[model samples]
Structure formats: structure tokens, C-alpha cells
Target: MSAASRAGSLPANLQGLWADGLNPPWSADYHININIQMNYWPAEVTALSELHDPFFRYIERLLPHAERTAKKAYGCRGAVAHYTTNPWGHTALDGRIVYGLWPDGLAWSALHFWERFDYTRNLGFLRDRAFPILKACAAFTLDYLVKHPRTGKLVSGPSNSPENTYIAPSGERGWIVMGAAMSQSMAFAILSRCEQAAALLGVEPELRARCREAIANLQRLEIGSDGRLKEWPEEFPEAEPGHRHISHLFGLHPGYEIDVDETPALAAAARKALDHRLAHGGGHTGWSAAWITLFWARLGEGERAWQFFEKLLRDSTESNLFDTHPSGGGPIFQIDGNFGGTAALAEMLLQSHAGRLRFLPALPKAWPSGRVRNLRARGGAGVDIEWKDGQAVSATLRPETTGTHRLIAPQGQRIARIEANGKSVAWKDEGVRLARGVVYRIAFQPAG
Candidate 1:
């Protein structure tokens, strides 16, 4: 993969060229809105953490150029990137208004750094590499958002939900608008991570405080009148109701703002939105299908998630396994579907996003008997689980750093017994305190 990718273009190329052409469709540029980010989706989940080095190197090279672009384009401090960028770090602001004005590109890319740190738990990397990028993303976000005069919410404006358009109440079509849920959600994610990263370092109290304040002012996601999370804070009808991009779901999957446990109402609304989209012919693209799979997994709907995965395998791939995007009159390959599907599959087997290691939270019935090993969890834990007949039978956990962490059974399924280092341990909602280098084994009671 590395050799082939490097062969395509120097200075690292996320969008690898399948065939040689100077003027390929979409210019073969790194699409930051989703494609470029999706290319690396499976890095940590598939245990390909080292493969992400190229992407980080690309970002490192792009940062200085992005800083200049931010100041020149938006008159904002810190770094920013438009929807499309090239290997030379040239930020493109073409005539297409829908794709041109997005500043959330950097915020989305910065997630890779945070995700890498989550899997590795390298304090040096978090403190030195990831935190700086996250801080800059937050800085740019802070500078970019303006107070919405009516609502007083810190919001980004004149930004379209990536590649999506809507119809105004005045019966006019609009692509660019204010406070798109995607932008606000991305801002919340970046700023929230900045707060977490800063609190971890403990040396940037002022920065941390500002991030906290910004977070407080950021617009909270609101559901529309139709029982769906609004694409924009203002209720506008989608120009393409079946649009494949699930940008509004940023908070549900990649971002942690909305969850099934804490934000159950919003989570339900998101599920309804997904149902509506699917009913209206959404999830047509491979990447969109993969995201819906992840969303279902996050919602613990294994059957639904697996159904999407099956569709992806059946409809969205070439013989060689490259994802095929069937837009622009014919099928063109996009690697994001492949990577995103792999990550979603992992999410179905195990989820650690909410500071808890959940076993088979969304295990599909078709995968009743299977095993997964060496999956990384937050707080530096290595997890391996075996299940049979749709129930987790046995599991093992090893933590790189000693700490107390929650280990939850699948939703309502209870852990009949848990043993740590060959001794019985009590289960608490707050979780158990674990020591470094200790191997904990868990066993579940047989199903009736």
C-alpha cells in the first residue's frame, strides 16, 4: 500500500491514481471534506497505525501553507484548508461556491491526530504533535465563528453542508448557508479535543479556558420539525432529499456530542433521519453507505449495520476491492468506502469511543461465532473477545497504562462473571481499577 501510494505522487498522496492522467476527474486532489479523511479511517482500527505516518507528514507539510491561506482567504488566525487541496498544499478556492468556502476541513483532518493518540496513548505524541495541531484547529475555529445576531450562538456561516444543498422557505435553492450542523459539530469536536488535549498537558490553562468558553458558546445540535436532526440550525428543506452525504451525522459517529446513553433523544432523532434517508434512496454511494453502517453500529443496531456492509460489498466495489463511486455518469474508484467499511466493521465488533470498552455492542447475528484480537481501546487497553450464538462467551483485556476503566457488556446483556488475573472482581457502573501488565479475563453466562 505504501509503495503504491508513494508511486502515485510525491509528498504523499491520499487520492492514489488508479491510472495515469494529468487531468483525471476531480483532478485527483486530496478531498478534505471526507474522501481524504476516509482514506485513513481504518489505520488505527485495522492495526495499521504506522500507515498513518504519510498522512501526518502530509498535514505537517500543509500546515504552514494552510496558515497563509487562512489569513489570506478568511482574514482569520491559525490554519485552514478549503474543501480541495493538492500535494503542494495549494488551497484551492475555485468558482464553485458549495465546495469553496468550507473552513471545517482542517477541523475534520485534525481528528486523525486525536484518533492516533487515542490508540497509541503516546504522551510525547499527544503533547508535542497532536496537541499543537488541535490547538491550531481550535484557534482557527474560534476566529472563524461569529455570533449569530438572533441566537447569540458562536456559529460558522456561508458554509454549505459538504456537497449538499437545500431549498429556502422562500422557494429558492441555496447551497451556502449559516451554521450548518456539520460545521458547528466539527467546531465542537475540535474545540472539545483541544480542551481535552490541553487538560492532559496541564501547561496551557488559558488556552484550555478559552476552549471551554468557546465550547459553551458553540451551537448545540437541534432536531428539525420533522423529527430529524436539522441539517442547518434553521429549518430548510434539502434540495436533494436523498442526498448521499450524511454530514449531519457527524456528531453521531466521528464526533462524540450525541450518544445513545447521554443524548438518547437526539440519538433517536438521528436514527429516524437515517431511516428517512434510506427510504428516500440515500446511502447510494459507497462512502455514504459506510457512514450509515457506522451510525447503526454506534446506535447498537447490528442487523441494520451489517445490512449496509453487505450492500457495500455487493454494490460498491470492484473485483480488486477498491470502492467504486458511481457518480459522473459511470463508476469511478474512491478508496474511502473500503477504509470506512473496514472501520465500521470493527465498530460493530467492539466500541471504545465513549471511554468504555463495549464488547459486541453491535454484533450482527450473521457473525454469531467469531473472534477479534489486538483491538486498541482508549486509555491504552488491548482487547480481544470471542463470542458464540450472538453472545460474548469469553474475553481478555490488557492495559498499557494502569487505570480504572469501564467495560460494559452488550447493551442490556449482563456479565455473569469477571476475573482479573485469576481472581474475581466486582462490577460497578463506574468501572474497575486495573493495574498495568495485568491480564483480565471475562466470561458471560450461557443464553437460555
Candidate 2:
């Protein structure tokens, strides 16, 4: 994938390097709704930060086209991109409103910029590149939202949850609605990050204020009476209970809005929603199963995540190890599942999304002993871990930048001691301050 994207004019699209025929599936275009984003999920965390450049450049190219779409289509400022785009920069809505009417594509795509900065802590990139795109995306979001008559919250609409549909309370099957969970979650992720980016760059106070207000007013994620996270603003029945998209759980995986520890209730709700989908025959596709793996990893369910990982391998993998999506006739190759599964493996080993670095957060019992090397963490650190009996015994940290960093032990364990260059070092339960050019090691105490 890196080779396909390296110094390329366009980023890796639907079929990274395997566009075989004249008319590839979905034209092998960039599906910003998820596919394109999934393509790079492991870039930062797998020590492949440079591989993200092509996607970043692609975003820059899409800006003008997206801006035109926002103004001409929605009469809004800034920019918006719908479901898919090609090398020619097609930011306009695609064929159907069911899948193409989404305006949060720009917002969702812009998150890559913030994520790059988050991993590298590159202030120059944050100021010059990420903030501009973030600000513009946030501006569009601010203008695009309307007050929901019932909840009185700022909500986006006339948009569907990617490719999923719901049955409205009035017995109407609809593709479009207000405040879809995925839309609201994407809006919140972009706006909150934009505000923080502005504060970091020390500019755009007015924009920052507007973002804060919108964030506060944006419709919150609702838990339905069914004990699942609501897909729409209301408890609407799903047209396909086993839909492959699972868009509502975006917050649990790619976005940090939902956390297992910080937001336990929402996390439980997300789990229930995922279980309900699986019960109704969800995760039937390769990419969807891979995404479920990520969700379970985030929720600290190693066994569940492993189950989906096996399912993805067993059901969705072709002879060449390529991920295959089931179609009318048979399964067709899709690049997203390959990438998403790679990311899921890395996520199970080390996760740094929730403001701290957690080692082996979801080590499945199937893997009783293992070791992984060169897993990158947020804050520009490289992590290596060795575990036995499904427990992390030791971890090595190599920091690229000198600073204080938060590190958590593996699940059901605690840090026994820390060493810098083989010498005991003072540390706190909260975090540790380290200097670059020194190697730090952490030994863990077994769970009682």
C-alpha cells in the first residue's frame, strides 16, 4: 500500500494497486465515507507515517472542488465532499442520495490531518496544513447544521448514515434524516479538533468560539430503549438490521468521542449495538468484520475481537489472502478489509487514541505468548512488547521527542518498575517524563 501511494499523484484508492479491468468496482474511486480513511488507519500506528503523505496531498487537491460543491449544492461556506471521489476530484454528490448526500466526508477526511499531527506532534504541519483544512471543514459544519425542532440541538441532515437506511416512526422507510449518529459524531470529532488546533496555533478565536458553541449544541449520542446506540436521532427501526456499514459505531473506533473508561455507558451502548448487528447477521463483509474487530479491541474485549478477526480471515479472505466482499454472484476483492485488519492487529497490541498509551489492551487468549516490534504510539514514540500467558511482561519505549508521556500497563496488570538505560527511574502512576536519546523499559506485575 505504501509503495502504491509513495510520491503518487493520487492516494491509494478503492483498489490500491490492483485495478485489473476497465471498469473496476465502484470505479476504484476514493470512498471518503470510510474506505479511503480505512486505507490509512495503520499508517501512523504501524511506523509508516510517511505513507500518509499521498492522502494528505489528495485532501489538498479536493479542497477547491469540495468548496465549490459546498457553495453550489448547499449554499454554504468552506467545503464538502460526498460519498466518493476520483483522481479528477469529483466532490459533487454521487448517484443516490441514500449514500451520496453525506456532507461530512470533508470533515471525516480532514481528521487524517489531525491524526497525523496527533501521532507526530508536528506543530508546523498542525499550523500550516492541518489547521487550515480543519478550520474550513468546521466552518462548513457550522453553516450546515440546523436547529432540530424537537431536540433544539444543532443537527445535520438531509443526509443518510452512509449506505444505511432506517424506518421512520411514521412507518416511512427513509434514507435521509437529521442528526444521524455517524454524522453528529464526525461533526463533533472535527469541530472539537479544529477548536483545539486553533488554540494550539493561536489563531481564529471567533472560529474557535463558534466551534465550542456548535459542539455543545450538537446532538449527543443516544442510547435506545433496546440498549443499543441509536442510529438516528430517534429510535428508528433499521431497514436492514444486519447492514454492513455499522456507521453509528464510528465514535467507538476511529473517533475518540466514545471511550470504554471515560464514557462507560456509551461504550456499553456501542457494544450492545454491535452485538445486535452481529445477531442479525452483520459483519458479513470483510471490511465490516474488520471494523468490528477494531470496535471490540477498543472496548477491551480481546476474545470478541479475536473472534471477528478469525471470521474475517475465514469467511472474507480469498486464496491470495486478498479481502473479498460478497456480491450477488460471489465475493469481489476490496482493499479496505486488508487495511482495516492490519490496523486491528496493531490496535490489539497497542492503542494510544484515548489520551494514553496502552499496551496489549486486547490480547486474545488464543495468543498465549507473543511479541511485537516497532508499533508507533501517539506522541511520536515507538513501542515494543513481549508477553507470556497472554500477559505483557515487558515493554520497551523509544521516544522521538523528549517529554512527559502517559503509559498504561496491559489489561489486568500494573507496572512493577521502570528503567532508563537499565537504571531505576522515578515515575508516577499518572505518567513519566523522559528524555530523548535514552531507551526506557517497563516491567509489569502479573495480575493477581
Candidate 3:
């Protein structure tokens, strides 16, 4: 039922974890939001050799607590109600989480699960854990996003951009400019996943009709101004001097929802907004750095991708993580930051931007000695890549993906030799193993 190919030939060790210049295990917990209840920062970062062992001990202390909470609260239906947090109704209530409304937390978790399962293809975990959660999460959204009043369309509102919003025109409402961002993205993800689940459960017409309706209602998020992706409705305005969350850039990099191949001009405008943020002291938070890393990777600024990761991951995370900046003093160990961190690292170490999956494409000059294997990137085709002396040394690609890819070699070299479905394409040392060491450009369909 799954359309994206999870199969690849990378050496098993490199499959699920991020590999750049370092390792960050605690970051993984942030990704899944193991407990989904506690508001603690994901974890603290520290010196690797000095801090790792004790960190594991710290995690061990937390495990039992996290396990209990995960089961009782957030497994799937646990986030059944939105709250301002405990006893005194004290926690700040941004419209990010909900029992039956916003499903970003659940959707976020599911995306990680999707990536992990795609990489490992381990069915034990699937039947035992994730698949069930994914099904329920999709079901929850189906019930939650019925229709919006003013738009009379299937819009998810009262939802802010992660945690950013401005006064609505009426000064009484919190209109989600990017409010629909996550939901729209979620709709596609849910439909695609529910469709996959349907094949397994034999879900009927009604199930899919909901998905169709959600997708139909989704065009609200893409408003534009002077050809750029509009951050808000123009009048409501964006946060001056910049805001922390790059939620509006949801369609840009990691999401794969928008890309140069599909939404080229929109992608370009997104870039313009990114430029505006950076120039205006839109101070880079940890997640901001992560988004920058992915954005640059997509734009094919290889060195920029590398620098973004190096600066962002090293300086923006806290000791609980790896580094940090001053403006937004947040948990050094938060998951959202780590997920963003890892995305940047992944884009730098290996990329599947455009259509061709690649390795070491935008490697930082400082990191010439490490190698990664088994990492899964999108584009339908699964590829395992390795490098030596800073250039791609080898790669094995499997077209388990439904789409086609014309491999581009490092340094933007011309593709001279290639083949698809076992047919030779000119046999001129063609395709040269898919740009083993640099970023590659591609179309949705790689034409022969």
C-alpha cells in the first residue's frame, strides 16, 4: 500500500540515525516525544566522551516515567483534549496541541515513525507499535477538521504557526495565517497514509472521502504577495525583526510538499522570505538553523548547507544538546530542535533533494573523515552512499521508488552513462553513480 520505496542498499549501520560530524542520541527522544506529557526541554547536551555515559544514566532515570506517561496519555488518543497545562491552568496555551483539534504533535511523531519504518522496514515494530498509532492519528484528524465557518471550507483554524500569531482584523480572533500550514501538510500526509492503511484494513469509501475533502480544503495556506509565499494575509503582518518558528516554510524542505520541481516560483519566494528573516536579525534559534540547513541544501548551496549545520548545531543547541544562541533561551534538550538539527545534518551528509538521492553532496570542509550508511531520503529511490577524502567514493542505488531518477555526478558533471530498469543510457560511463559528492538537481520525472 505504501507508494514511497523504503528499500535501499546502504550498509545497515547508517540506516536510521543521523551522521554528520557527531552523534546525538538524546535528540532521538525529542523526535518521538516519548512521553508527550512533560514539558521538559528534550535533554541537555554536553561533552561527548565526558557526558554520554552519565546522560544515558539520566535517561534511564526518566525512562520509567516517560513509559508510564506515554501509555496513559499520548500513545494515540491520549491527546484528547487541549489544555493550558496543570493545576492552576498555568501553562501558556498556544494553539499547538489538542485532544481533538490540532494534531501537530501526533503528526510530527508519525512523520518520524514513517521515516524510521521506511529506513528499517522492520515489521515487528510496525504491527506492534507505530502502524496502530498512525492509523489513529489519521482518524483523529478526520474527525477534527470538518469545516471552517468564515471560509466555509475544510480549514483547520485556531491553530497558530507552531507558536506564532498576530491579532486578526477584528482584533478578537487569532487567525492562523500559517494556521492551516500544519493541517494542510497533515491532510496530504494523512490521506497518503490512510490510503496505505486502507490497503491493509480494506477501509471503505467514506474513509477516503474525508481525506479528499481535507486535501480540497487545503489550498488556503498558499497565499502569495508579489509572487512570494505570503507569511500572513498581508494586513495582519509578520513578526517584525523575525520570529523563531519557520512554520511558514513548512512546504520548503523536509516536508517534500513543495519543491522546485512542483512549486518552483513559490520555492523561490520562500527563499526571499528566508533572506528577509536572516538580514533583519531574525536571530537563528536551534530549529531555525536546522531549517536553514535544509533550505540551503534544497537550493544547492552545498557549502552553505555545511556551514549552516556547523554553526547552527554547534552554537544553537544547549549543553543538554550540542550548542545554543541567546535570544530564545529554551531547553537545551528539546526534541523539535534536535529533529531540526538532525534534518540539517542529514541534508548536509546526504540529500535526496530534487529527485536523485545523493551522499556527501554538501559536506562541510571541516568534515572529511566520516562516513554514513543506510540513511533513507525521499525521492522514492533508496540509495546508500559513502565517501573518502571528501568526495563520494561509492554508492548503490535501488529503484524501489515508483519514480525515475537520472543520476548526476559530483561537481555538477554531465551525466554521460546511465540506465533505468536495466536498459543502458548511452553507456558513456553514464550517470557516474549519482553525483556522489555534490548536490544534484532533478525533476519529478527524470526523462530519458
Q: What are the TM-scores, per candidate, against the unseen true structure?
A: 0.95, 0.98, 0.63
How well does model 2 score by local distance difference test? 0.90
RMSD of 3: 10.1
Q: What tens digits encode model 1's per-residue C-alpha lDDT throughout 1-448? A: 4543442244223335463467666777688888878777777776677778777777877888888887888888888887877777876466478767787777788889999998877889998889988988888888889899998988887698988888888898888877999998998899889899888888689888988998898888988888998888778777888998889999998888888988999999999989988998999989889989999999989999999999999999889888878876888777778878988998998888877778898988899798999887777778899988788888888888888788788755777887886789887887988788989888876543
The alpha-carbon RMSD values of the candidates against the true structure, listed in the order shown, are 2.1, 1.2, 10.1
Query: How do the residues 207-325 of candidate 2 rate in per-residue lDDT, one tens digit apiece?
Result: 99999999988998999998899998778788999999999999998999889889999999999999999999999999999999999999989999999999999999998999998
Off by over 4 Å in 1: 1-22, 446-448
The 0-to-1 C-alpha lDDT of every candidate, in the order given, reads 0.83, 0.90, 0.48
- What ranking emerges by TM-score with the best candidate at the front? 2, 1, 3
Comparing 1 with 2 on lDDT, the higher-scoring candidate is 2
lDDT of 2 at 202: 88
What TM-score does candidate 2 reach?
0.98
Q: Residue 110 in model 3: shift from native, Å?
A: 1.9
Q: How many residue pairs clash in each candidate?
A: 0, 0, 26
The order by descending lDDT is 2, 1, 3
Candidate that scores best on lDDT: 2
True-vs-predicted CA distance for residue 97, candidate 1, Å = 0.9
